[model samples]
Target chain A: MRIAFIIIAIVFVALTIAFTILPMGTIALIPVALAFLFSFFAFFKSKERKRIFSKWLMFFVFVLFLVIVAKDVFVKDKVVTDQKFQLEKQNSQQEAQKELEELEGLK
Target chain B: MKKILTIGVFLSFIRICTGQISPNETLIFDGSYELSGMMTNIAQVTMQTSVMKTTNKSYLHLSAEVATFNKWDSFFKIRDLYESYVDPGTLKPSLYKRNVYEGGYTKTEKYSYNPAGNSIKSESKRKNNPVVKNTVSIQPGAVDVITLIYKLRSANLSGLKAGQSIPYIIVFDEKQLRVNLKMLGKEIVSAGNLGKRECYKLSISANTNKLKGADKNLIWLTTDSKHIPCLIKFSIPVGVGQLSLLKTAGI
Candidate 1:
């Protein structure tokens, strides 16, 4: 059916997009493909006219784009252990400095 | 799948080695503990065999044939002896007297120490001095012999506390064997008469830069404050043999 063809085409496009993204992008794309499939199934079974089905497909495409963006925002975990470690060590150094200052006063 | 399983098994073994013994006390090593879990052929090897040993805290004194292993391509095969020990408990060794009568030459070493097994000092001689070559010296400041009278502070059969790696390297003469060591963790180990005991252990391997291409000794010492060597193992290119602690008790 024409609707089935659209669903398959959308899934292929989503998978192609996943390859260029992060390690987990392949997983993030699954929901988007499913959403496209659901809309296609709805369009085929609906008594509504072609124009109405077109609107539903458009809505799903928009939802898919949002998911991809949300994934990119949440999955990044850029971490700098070196900088954090230095900051922690700084706190200890400050304590040692205070101890030394007190010792100097005693002298 | 295979690699994952191997990693899992290795991790669990580490846990087993660490989880059973608590260091009631710790043996202090100034720079780092020396001697390794892996075998090292000394100037002499003493082969010990015992006929009788109690299950509780007891001691076994036996005589063994000391040996050396020849090596090729990092693999070791037992070779002719460089030196051998008679009584490891005493330094005045009963040497394997050499003779040329049978077109063969064999010699034994001398020395003896504690047979108590409850302390590092009591364990068999790590340094079997056959040639007794000038009590060879090296760093962190060396002297021929360094002896300590170790006291066993505590003993129990609890799974590893926060920090007890079974079969850990307790102590060594950096001046003698001259090898760097490390603590891997603990495990359920068999003792002479104690049936089985969970022990903290330490292991040592030759650092590539330290010594190259020798594979006869794989020393796995227990991690007790006593620094008991529950297992001293050696792998020949074709085979391996082990001296495991059967039972250990307070001295």
Candidate 2:
């Protein structure tokens, strides 16, 4: 029984490091797999307090990672295109009105 | 402690991901919206832009006094016909890059006019220096030569208002100003790193006689007053680029 527990702990350590270090968008999936594994193990070993502890811990980590990944994906992407020539066009027309009014009033 | 820290990091990431709130809901009338945006067909540079909308007209304006002054050498290296400077009278293309005063005024404006207000004139200029891409390009307001442009008039920015797309062919001051512009409908676009925003994306096109792609202009204006142009993609064979409005104007 102790050997089985030791192997599980070793696997957990390996998985945790992979989850943290893989980089890119895939890191988000780590906690979820960890959570599922822990939860499945707890279902089979319901009487063990260690199983409950691991299960809850892994689930919490999963939720947190999911949030982080979603944040990165949803950030805004935008740019500016200055409309100088357009402004010149519109304003020049308005300026023409003022110029014409000035000329007419002068007359 | 390790588990706690790991969870904490992920939680922080989530906060960042979901923190993108929409633009604020205040100030939702009908006028142009300015965005903290920039474009670079040359290199990675940001420019300021403004987009305006009325019942019958819409337009975008973009400019970077710094970019116009500091010509990118890398950009010149790529394009064959596109050099930093060219001969004025002959319009001959040349790679001769000239340095000018590094700053000047940048302005953009759009308006609605009756048919009687067609001719464009009455230009003001900076006393000594001018805002020319090249010193030899042309003096600001020197000849009062009106260049080519596309016209826009629309309601709610979902493409040009129904029945308002004119193949605008006008002869003003002996210059043939012809344009073919069409709107590309509405889209939900991101305005900032904050969140997604719904906007009307208008495609701008300018036909060229003096220049290759002088008749194209693209702009994205918010249907609402978050008043942001979520995205604007212009064109070139002339000089243009893509720009997006802020996704989160605190809305």
Pick by TM-score: which candidate is best?
A: 2
- How does the DockQ of candidate 2 come out? 0.01
What total of clashing residue pairs does each candidate reach? 57, 45
lDDT of 1: 0.35
Please list the Cα RMSD from the true structure of every candidate, rounded to 1 decimal place: 26.1, 21.2
**Residue B109 error for model 1, in Å?**
6.0
Which stretches in model 1 have alpha-carbon errors above 4 Å? A1-107, B1-105, B108-137, B140-177, B207-224, B236-239, B247-250
Kindly report the docking quality category of candidate 2.
incorrect
Name the lDDT value of residue A105 in candidate 1.
46
User: On a 0 to 100 scale, what is the lDDT of residue A46 in model 1?
Assistant: 55
lDDT of 1 by residue, B1-251 (tens): 99999999977654443333222211211111112232222212232322222222112222222222211112222222111121212211111111111112332222222133212111122223334322222232211111111111122323445333322121232223433333445676765454465555534344333333343454444454334545555443434445554334332
Model 1's CAPRI class? incorrect
lDDT of 2 by residue, B170-221 (tens): 3322234454445556678766663676666555443554333532465666
Positional deviation of residue B13's Cα in model 2 after best superposition, in angstroms: 49
